[model samples]
Target: MFCYQCEQTTRGTACTTQGACGKTPDTAALQDLLVHAAQGISQYAHRLGKMGIRRNAADAFTLDALFTTVTNVNFDPDRLEGLLRNAAALRDTLRADYAQACAAAGQAPEALSGPATWEPAPDLAGLVAQGQAVGIDTRIAALGADLAGLQELVVYGLKGAAAYACHARLLGREDESVYAFVQEALTALAEDEPSVDALLSLSLRTGAMSVTVLALLDGANTGAYGHPVPTPVLMGHVRGKAILVSGHDLKDLEELLKQTEGTGINVYTHGEMLPAHGYPELKKYAHLVGHYGGAWQRQRSEFDAFPGAILMTTNCIQQPAPGYADRIFTSGLVAWPGVTHIADHDYAPVIQAALAADGFTDESPVRHHLAGFHHDAVLGVADKVIEAVKGGAIRHFTLIGGCDGAEGARSYYTDMAVALPQDTVVLTLGCGKFRVIDQDLGTVAGLPRLLDMGQCNDSYSAVKVALALSEAFGVGVNDLPLSLVISWYEQKAVAVLLALLHLGVKNIRLGPKLPAFVTPAVLKVLVEHYNIMPIGTVEDDLKAMGLAA
Candidate 1:
């Protein structure tokens, strides 16, 4: 199995033996098979859509299947095998529909090849063989790394969009155009021959689609939970039975909070869920206690000592350690071989687990962190911010946001945040904020020096803020005294980066290292077109951003 779809891919290359995220060879093979199967489904689904037919089931499956293949989301072979079988079944059904539509239109059904014509074998062994037959290397050999990388880039961005769309769908938000683009792009990836130029164009289209989906998700979240406001969250242990909710699903977190209310159990946010505390609807729950740890990469140690039940609502789930495996529960497409999964939005089992385990006996001293500086909150203070900028009290604005990983180079973000001058305002999102979240950057013009926008998808908030600032100053976004220093680890970050590029945002610095899947030619294209650069030392990047460190 060869996988290099993430930042921590072995030696900044391929993970050939075992995934750096703890995915085994068997699981990696299954994920590849699942992606291939989704592509096949897309082939027929795309054709069906052109025939004036829409199948919401196929569209939903396509999103979930791709999301499941995201790194560290699912390690359960049994679950993957089920998804593969379901994908094949969906493909066959859609193919029949396409044929029926063609025949009804008095035209001969075109004979399709590639994934469209291929058949899956009966068992796991046969499926693995089929996966090996159409692996990444085969595609690279046929199309060259440049084109292959472009195709994979498009697919990964689609996956990220699908993940965000899935969350939005949970709250009854659906956009037909988003689903249409997802199927259309997947079918394009499975085409007989794809040119680098066409694929690059499609990659940008994927970015545009991602922007739309993220906006839809933002609406769903804010509509359901009310707009996020500035709120102080405790960072220490709380007394009594506790349950830690992680990942980026606000719906799941809300359900758990509702069920745990008045039961004498405390709910604490972890990882990406840290921003949930700022939403008025969620914050109204008194038992929804403060945040518990850093980012997703630190979960093993954090989960083990937490002394309560844990619920992982979405991706970034690592291999569970034995000490906490039984107590940890997964929901909404996250799965592990032996972990308990909660479906149907039920929380009785989770509540039972929390009661069964030993929760905190005495509370630790409370420490507070301010969050919820989303677009609305930031833009609400636009006048004050503009005044400060014009008066030279605030010299610059820097956005240090993206995914966080286990890489040592990630410390650069914390270093840069700490070294920024007092007159600078730091806006951050995603789990990467964990690096500098502990530091008190103090207030600037009556605003916290560091503003915590929601999750990675909340890059939408940052974009909105930038566009608003640009409008206020009568200049383009790039002309403002702002810089984006991003650190990425997964496909969601890919989607966000592409959206930034799509908006013509320039001089962005991306690091812990470039994606291994991005060929040199593609990298050159990005550098030339977007002026994207990799991060240097903390001091040098500060200087380059026009800061006197």
Candidate 2:
């Protein structure tokens, strides 16, 4: 069960015995097996695609499988076992379709090996055994650290893309190219004789795909709920039976809000769902109360203290503490053993839990935090931003955002945000915005110094704004007065990083730490190609970004 696909991998190295995210050996094995099964499906699906056939089911399943393998998303062995069986079944279907398509085209069907030829065992233990056979170390042993690390890099990016795609798909939005790339890249990963250069190229392509998926998700979210606006969300809660909706699933949050409406139950966004408040449609619901808690890592204490039901919509789930474990429920791809899983997005059970619990008796004093300054919101004021830059009202623009973890070093984001000069407009995204959202950076360039741009996928928004600013100033994006200080914890941040690299964005400082899976040689290649570097102390980074403060 060697897993190092996340930033918090044990000691900044691979997790050999257990996951730092509370994933047990058995659960890790199941995730590995599920990923292996997806690879098998992709082998067949990719072939079918080349044969002028579209295996959309296999493509969809492949993304979901990879997404489930993401850190802290699904810890329930039973749920993973179910996905494994489903993957095997999906692979079989794709295999038969591939054979039929080949026969009809008068071409010989290739006999796929590796995971393609393997079979999942009859039971959970058997499946775990099968999964253990194809864990990360197996690939490292086969291809060596450099290339295998590159392949894992690609896979992690794909996982991040899949997460955004899943959220988009829930709102009935998707792109066929994103799905095709998943199959094609997974097929490449399943190859025995992998090429470093080819894998490196694939990593960039995965980044490009991440960019596409993020855009697709952005369109889906904005289309469904309307583009985010500069709305003020209550940092304080209201008096009522409350349900806290966490994770990045806007659709799930909308469903819960709809169900709990007029029932005296207030639905508060948590973690990545904080941006939901800025959506016109979602904000139209009066019962959609203010946000509760901070980032995902703080959920244990936050969820424990909240006297209401808790619903996890996606990743960012930690082990449920005994005190408030039962009050919590899982929806979408989030699952924990013994936790109530909500299928079909129904909120009856979640609502019941909220109703059964003691509501917030006394409301906290009124307080507010500004969120939602998405690409459109920011771009709508582009004239002022451009003028501010020309007039020296805004000296610089820094994009400081990414996933938030429990790491002590994560405070660097806050420090940097706080330390940035007032003339610099700070654009932020992801749950990491929790660090800077509280700071009243005041107005810069006729806008708030700190602009909250939706969730992690809204890195797209940052990219869009950068491109717009570059065009407005008649310069390249790299030449704009901008710097990206990204803090990554999980696969989604990796995907976003790839997207940045793909866009030829350079000189970015990434931290709290570098991924353990990134071999030195691979890191050297990235640094040489993209000018990427690990983040340093806030003071040094600020100086590097040309900030005197």
- Best candidate, lDDT-wise? 1
Residue-wise C-alpha lDDT for candidate 1, range 1-549, written one tens digit per residue: 778789999999889899999998888888888888888888888888888898988989999998998887999988888888888888889988988999899998877777776677788888777777777878888889888888889888988888899999999999988888888887878774788789888988888998898899999989999999989989888789999999999999999989998999999999999899999999999999889989999999999999999999999999888889889999999999999999988999999999999999998887998889989898988999999999999989999989999988899999999899999999999999998888888988877899999799688999999999999999999999999999999999998888888888999999989999998899998899898899999888887888965
Query: What TM-score number comes out for model 2?
Result: 0.98
In model 2, residue pairs whose N, Cα or C atoms come closer than 3 Å (at least 3 residues apart or on different chains), thus clashing, are none
Q: Distance from true position, residue 423, model 1, in Å? A: 1.2
Candidate 1: where are CA atoms >4 Å away?
none
Q: For all the candidates, what are their Cα RMSDs to the real structure?
A: 1.1, 1.1
lDDT of 1: 0.89
Q: What tens-digit string does per-residue lDDT give for candidate 2 at 20-106? A: 899999999898888878888889988888777887788678888988988889999988888887887888888888888888989
| TM value for model 1 | 0.98
Query: How accurate locally is residue 441 in candidate 2, as Cα lDDT from 0 to 100?
Result: 91
